[model samples]
Target: MGIVDSKGHLYLKEDPEVWIKNNPASRLALVTSFRLNLENGVEEIAESIGELTHLIHLVFRWCRSLKRVPNAITRLHKLEHLLFHSCSRLEELPANIGNLVSLTHLQLSHCEDIKFLPNSIVNLSKLTSLTLCHCVSLVELPANIGQLASLTHLKLSSCRNIKSLLMSVANLPNLTSLSLSSLSLSEIPYNLGDLKKSLTRLDLSYCNNIEFLPNNIANLSNLTSLSLICCNSLIELPSNLGQLKSLSYLELYYCNKIKSLPDSIKDLCSLDTLIINCCDSLTHLPINLNVLHLKLLNFCPRFLPNGLINLKYLRVNICSCSDESFVNWKDPYSLQHLAISSCFSHCNYILKVPASLNQFVNLQVLSLHYKKRFVELPANLVGLAHLCLLDIQHSSISCLPWSITKLRRLRHLMLPKDFRLETLSYELNISVIISVNERHVRKTWEELKTEIGQLPIPFGGEITNDAAQNPSIMSHPGYLWLKENPSQWIINNRNLLKLVRFLDLEYVELTDSIMQFSELTHLCLDIAADICLPDNYFVTFTRLTHLSLHFFSVGKHKSITHSLSKLSNLQTLHLHMHHSVLLANFNMPVSLKYLSLSYCNNMRPLYDSLEKLTNLKTLDLYSCV
Candidate 1:
C-alpha cells in the first residue's frame, strides 16, 4: 500500500487499498493524513492526489526537488493542513488553491523560487496560520488579504522582496500575531489600529525604510508586544502610545532617528518590559518614566531618569554623556538583576558606581561591561546577601573587593579573559566559570553540581538513581552529574553519574575517578599549571570524541600530550593556550577529524605532523601570532 518511489511519475493502476491497510471494507476510504517522502530521483507528484477524498493533511516537507504542487489538490474537500516546507525548487502554487475551503494551516517556508501567492488565497475562510518565511522571491501578498477572517498568525519574515502590505490587512478582525521581519516594507497601513480588539503581537524588525508609526496605533489596546528592531528610518513613536493599556513589551533597537519619548508614557500602567538601544539621537527620557512596576528594562540614553523603584532586571548603557541622576532603589526591594555598559567611544575613563547599589538587599545577579572604564564597586557588599551571579569583563580594575569572599550564596563567578587573580578562599566553594558566549560558558565541576541541584526531580526534588527512569532528568546541559562534595542525594545514587555526557572543569586535577564515566563524550579543562594524568587516563573514555584544553603553562606538556595520545576515539580537539612560550609541538591522535589551535600566539606550522592527520577535515589556527 505504501509507494516509496515513483520517479516523477504516477501509476493510477495501483489499487488505492494499498495505501490503507487497516481494513478491507474501507479500501476506497482515503486516510485523514497522507505524508509522502519522495525518493532521491523523484521530482514530482502527479495529479492523482485529487483521488484522496478524505485527506485532511498532506505534508511534503523536505521534498527539495519538487518544482510544483498539483492543482488537483483543490479537489480535497476536507484538507486542513498542507505543508511544503523546504520545497526549494517550487516556483508557485496553483492559482486556484483557495478552492480548499477547509484548509486551516499552510506553510511554504524556504521555497526559494516562489514569487507570488494566488490572490484567491484570501478566500480561505477557515485559514488560521499562514507561513511563507524565507521565500526569497515573494514580492507581495494579495491586496484583499484581510478577507482571511479566521487568520490568527501570519509570518512573512525573510521575504526580502515584499515592499509593502495592502491596507486591507488592517480589516482582519481575528489576527493576533503578525511578523514582517527582514522585509522591504516602507510603511504599514495606518488603519492597522482596527485590529485593536484581537492583535496581541506585532514584529516589524529589519524593515529599514519605515519612518514612523501611525498615530492611530494607540487604538491597539489589546496589543502586548511590539518590536521595531533595526528600523533605521524610524524617527518617532506615536504620541499616544501610552494609551495601549495592555502593552507589556516594547522593543526598539537601532532606530537612530528617535530623539525623545512622550511624557505620557507614564500612563502605561501595565507595561512591564521596555528595551530601546542604539538610538544615537536620543538624549533624554520622560521625567516620570519609572512609575510602572517594570520587571525588565534595557535602555541607552545620555541622561537616565530616576523613578525606577520596582525593576527586577535592568540593563543600562550609558552614552557619551556623564551619569547625572542617581538610581532609586525601591524600598520594598524588588530589584534582582542589574547590568551596566559604558558607551564612551572616544576616551577611557573611570566610572563611579553610586554606593547606593548596596540598597538592593534582594539583588541576585550583577554584570558590568566596561569598554575602558574602571568602576569603583561598592565597598560593602554584605547587604546584597541574596546575590548569586557576578559577571565582569573588559574593565580596568585593580582588584576584586575582599568582601567578594564573603558572598556565600554566590554560585557563578565569570571573569575577563586576561583576569589575573589566581587564588580564592576555598571556603567560598562556588564554581568559577569563564564566559565563552551568550549561550554556552565554561563551567567547573562544583558549578555543575549547582546546576544539577536546580533540576526538577521527582523524589524529594533530588536526582536519585531511580529518577533516571523519568526521561526529563538529563534533558538539559545543566542537568548533569559531576564529582563535587558528594551530597547525600548523590551518595545514595552513584549510578546517576553514568548519565552525564558532558564535563567542564576549571583548575581541577586529573584523576583516575574520571575514567569511571563511561558515557562522557565531551570534556573541557582549564589548567593553570601542570597536571599529571594516570597512565590509562583515556583508555576507558571510548565515547569521548571532543576534548578542549585551555592551558596557561607548558609545565604539563609531556603529561598532557601523553594522556591525549591515548584518546584513540577523539575526533575533535581544541587548544586555547594564548601565551607564546607554551608547547609549540603536539602529538595528536590520527583519528582527529577537526583540530583548532586558537590564540596560540607563537605556534608555527608543523607541516610534517599535520600531514600525519590525513583524516582531518578542518584545521583552524586563528590568531597564531
Candidate 2:
C-alpha cells in the first residue's frame, strides 16, 4: 500500500476494504515503497505497519513534529533504504533497527534532537551509506563501525560535539568518501592511513581546533582532493604529502599558523588548482612549482613563484612590495587573466603599471582597482592584440589611454564611477562600456552601434537584387555577416532587440519601455542600494526563467517580494544586498528551483516562508552576517 499523509487518520484502516479490497494479502507481499514527506502535525506513526514485510523504501522527510517512529517497523526483512531527513523533533532510533538485514542506505540529516545511533546498527553488514549531518547532539560512533565491510560513504558533517573518529574507522576496506566538516573535531584517528587504496576525497573544513593532519596521510595513494579551510590552529602540512600520486586539487584558506608550503609539493604531477588565501605568515612559494594552471595568492604578495610561466589565471593582493620588485615582474607566457589590487593600507600609494605589461601578447583580461594609487596605463597597449576586457575602477588616471582607443578587438570596458568627459578628442570605436552611469555609456554604445550597422555595402561584394528579395536570405543576415562586424556588434544590433535572449542592466534607470523585450529568458538587474523597484514592473517578463537582483535597501524588500511573486515562470532567483537590508517575510514563487542570497547580513532566521518553497532544490548563502 502507498503511504498517505503523516496524520494518523490518513493511514489505512484495519479493514481490507479500505486498501486493495480484491486482494488484502498484497499488503504484506507486494507493497515496496512508502513516502510521507512535508507533513507537520504528525507526532507518532501507527504500529500497524509491521505487516509490510516486503517494503523496500521508507521516507519521512521534513515531518518536523514527528517525535518517534514505531519500533514495529524493524520487522521488515526486505527494506533497503530508510530516510528521516529534517525530522527536527526525532530524539532517537529504535534499538533493534539492525533487524533489517537488507538495508543499504540510512539518512538522518537535520535531526536536531538525535543524540546517538544504536550500537545494534553495526550488525547491518550490508549497509553501504550512512549520513548524520547537522545532528547537533551526536557525540560519537559505535566502536565497531569499521566492521561493516560494505560501507563506502560516511558523512558526519556539522555534528556539534563530535571531536574524533573511532580508531577502527580506517579498517572499512570499501570506504571511498569521508566528510567531517564544520565540527569540533581536533584529531583524526591514528589508523586513518589504513584506507589508503579506497579513499578518494577527504574534507576537514571549518574544523578550527584541528592542529595538524596525521603524518601517515601520505599513504593514501588513491586520494585526489583534500580541503583544509579555516583550520586556524594548523601549523603545517605533512612533509610527505607529495607521496599521493593521484592528488589534483588543494586549498588552504585562513590557516593562520601555516608559514610556508612544503617543497615536496613540486612532485604532485596532477595538481591543477591551488589557492592560498589569508595565510599571514606565508612569504614564499615552493621553488619548482609548475603543476598549477590557476593560482590565487592573496594577502601574501611578497612571494612570487618562478616556474609559473604557463599560468592562465592569477590574482594577487600585494601588501608589502618595493617599486623595484613590482616593476621587474615578468608576464606569464600564456596568461589570459590578471587582476591586481593592494591592501587597504597601501591603497593610497602611487603604484605604476609595470612597463613589462606590453610583453603579455596573449593576455585577454586585465583589472586594476587601487583608487588613489593607480595613475596611468602603459603608453603602448597595441602589443596586447588579444585583449578583450579591461576593467579600471577608482583609478587616478585623467584621461582614457590613447593606445586603448586603437584596440580593434576590445569588446567590453568598465570605467571608474567618477569619470565624466567634457570633450571628445578620440572616437570610442568599442561596442560596450558597462558602467554604473548608463546615461553616458548607453548613449556611446548606441552611437557606435549605428555607425557600424550603417556601414555602406562594398562595391564588388554587393549582393544581387534577386538575392536580397529572397525570403530566406533576407530573414537571416547574421548567418552570412556575423564574421564581418566587430566581436560585440551582435549584442548591440538595432534589429536584434527581439533576438536578445539575455540582458544585464546595472545602475540604470528603470523605465516601462524596458518591458518591450518579451523574449528575455535571463535578466540581471543591479540597482543602487537605496533605490526601489518601480510599481507594476515585474509582470511584463512572464517568460523569464532566470533572474538576479543586487544591491537592495531595507524598505525595498516588500516591493522586491511583490515583484518576484509575479514571475511564475522563473526557475532561478538570486538576491545580493548590503549587510543592512533585513528580510523578515516574503513570498517566493513556487516555480523557483534554485535560490541564492549573498551579503544579506541582517536577514532574520529563515523558516516558514522557505518551507513553502517545496520545489526548491538548492539554496546558497554566502558571507551573510
Candidate 3:
C-alpha cells in the first residue's frame, strides 16, 4: 500500500492503477505531488496522469523497465519538478517536455540510454536547476540552453561523451553555480567568464584532461568557492586568481601536477578555507595567506606564516617537516581545532608538539596520531581551559600527566585501544582494583558475594554459583572487580564526571561506576569476558545516542535483547559478536537509524525483529552467515 499525506502528496511503490481505481477523480485532482518508486516491472505511465492538474512534483525512481515518459505529462502546466533516477532502461524524455512552462527543476541520473536533450528544452524559461549525472551516453546539450534566463544551478557529471559545452552557456546571466566533470575537454569554454557577475561557485572535479585554466577566469569577482579535486593533468592556475575578492574556499586535492600556487594568493583577504592535499609534486606554499582553516597533507612547505591571527582550524598529515615549521606562529590565539598525524609507517621523522602551544588559548579540539616516536605531552595543559575533545589514538604515549584532571570542560577523551585498565584507573585516581587467581578465587569470591548483595541486581540476573566456581571463568585476565566507594579524586572532580559525553574502552569490566557519566551520548565497549551489565544501566542513559558493543566470547546472556530495547534514545547501534552467539529474539530500539552487525551467524532469526524498526535507514551486515 502507498501513503498519502494530509497535504495531498501520494507516494506509491505499487501500480498506480490499483490506487486510482479505489479513489474518486475529484480526490485525485487535489494531489500536488506524486512519487513512484521500485516498481521494477512498470514500463509506462498511463496518459490519464495528465488529469491531475494540480500536480507540482513528479518522480520515478528505480523503475528499471521504464523506457519513455508520456507526452501527456506536459499537459500539467503547473508541474514544477520532474526527476528520474536509476531508471536505466529509460531511453528519452518527451520531445515537448518544455510544455510544462512552470517547471523549475529537472534531474536525470543513471539513465544510460539517454543521448541528447530535445532542443525544445530551451523553452522552459522558468527552469532554475538542471542536473544530468551518470548519463554515460549523453553527448551534447541544447545550443540554446541559455534561453532559461531563470536558471541558477547546473550540474553535469559522469557524462563522458560530452566533449565540450556550447558557448551559449555563458549567456545564462543568472546562473550562480556550475559543475562539470568527466569530460574530454582540455580547457573550459573561453566565454565562461561572461557569467562573472553572478557565478559564485565553480567545480571541475575529476576533469582529468584539463591542463590549465584561462586567465579570464579571474573575472569572476563574486566567486566564493572553487574546487579542482582529482584534476590530475592540471598543472597551473590563473595567475590573477587573487582578484576574486569574495572567494572564501579553495580545494585542490589529488591535483599532483600542480607544483606551486600563484604568489598573488596572498592578496585574497576574504579567503578563509584552503585545502591542498596529496599534491605530491607541490614544493612550496605561499607565505602569509589570510585563511582561517587550512589543511596540508603529504606536501610540506619549507616555511609557514609568522602570524595568522584569524586562523582557527589547521590539519597537517603525513608531512615530513621540521619542528620549526609549526612553532613559528606568532599570534595563534584564535585557533579552535588542531590535528597533526604521521601516517607513513616507514617514515622515521618524529613530530613534536610546539613548545609555544600554550599560546592557543581558544583551542578546543586537539588530535595527534603517531605510530611510535610521539611519547609524551607537555606537563602543564591547564592553559587550555576550553579544551573539549582530546584524541591521541595510535600514539606511543603510555601515560598522561596528572594535571589533565584540571580540564573541567573535557568531555571526549580517546585513548589508544591497547591502553591497560590499571594505567587508566591510576591516572584517573578513581578505582581500587581486585585481582582473583585460581588459588584465592574462593576467598575473593566470598568477600565479593557480600559486596554484591548490597548492590543492585544486574541485568540478565546475577552470576551463578557454578559459573563463579569454575577456575577458567574466575581467573579470566580481563576481569577487574572494583570497590563501591570511589577515591577522593573522583569526589573532587564531580563536574568532570557529569560533563563527560563519550567513552571508548577495551577489556574493562562493566560496573556501577560507569553510571556516573549521566551526560554521555556515545559509549563503546570491547569486552573479552562473559560479563553482564548492571541493572537499569541503559535506562539511565536517556541522552545516549550511539552505542557499540563488541563481544569476544559466547555466554548465557538471554537478557541482552531486553537490555538494549530499554534505550529509547539510541540512534546508532553496532554489535560485533562471536559467531557462536545466538541472535534469536534480538530486538533493537525503534528509534535506531543505523544498525551494523558483524561476524554473527544464524541471522535469519533477526529478520522478524528488524521488520519493526520503521525508522531504520541503514543496515550493514558484515561477515554474517
Q: Assess candidate 1 and give its TM-score to the true structure.
A: 0.61
Record all residue pairs in model 2 with backbone atoms less than 3 Å apart, i.e. clashing: none
Model 3 lDDT-worst window of ten: 471-480
* Ranking of models by lDDT: 3, 2, 1
Which candidate, 1 or 2, has the higher TM-score?
A: 1
**Which pairs of residues have clashing backbones in candidate 1?**
1-18
**Residue 303 deviation, candidate 2, in Å?**
1.5
lDDT of each: 0.67, 0.68, 0.72
For each of the candidates, the C-alpha root-mean-square deviation to the true structure, in angstroms, is 16.0, 16.7, 14.2
Q: CA shift at 482, candidate 1, in angstroms?
A: 34
| Model with the higher TM-score, candidate 1 or 3 | 3
Q: Model 3, residue 455: what's the lDDT?
A: 18
TM-score winner among the candidates? 3
Per-residue lDDT value at 195 in model 1? 92
Q: lDDT (0-100) at residue 225 of candidate 1?
A: 91
| Candidate 3 lDDT, 1-625, residue by residue in tens | 3656888799888657667777788888878999888567788877777777789999888989998877888999999999999999899899998899999999999999898899889899899999999999988999899888999999999999998888898999899999997776778999888888999999999999999898888898889999999999999998998898999999998998998899889889899899988887886777778899988766553345655677889887644454455565666788899887663532576665554556678889988866565655665687788887777765655445545656666666665533222222122212212222111211222232322121122233323224342221111111212222323323544534543444555565566667776766666677665677654457788877777777865454555556788899887777777675555667788988777677787887678787889988667676788
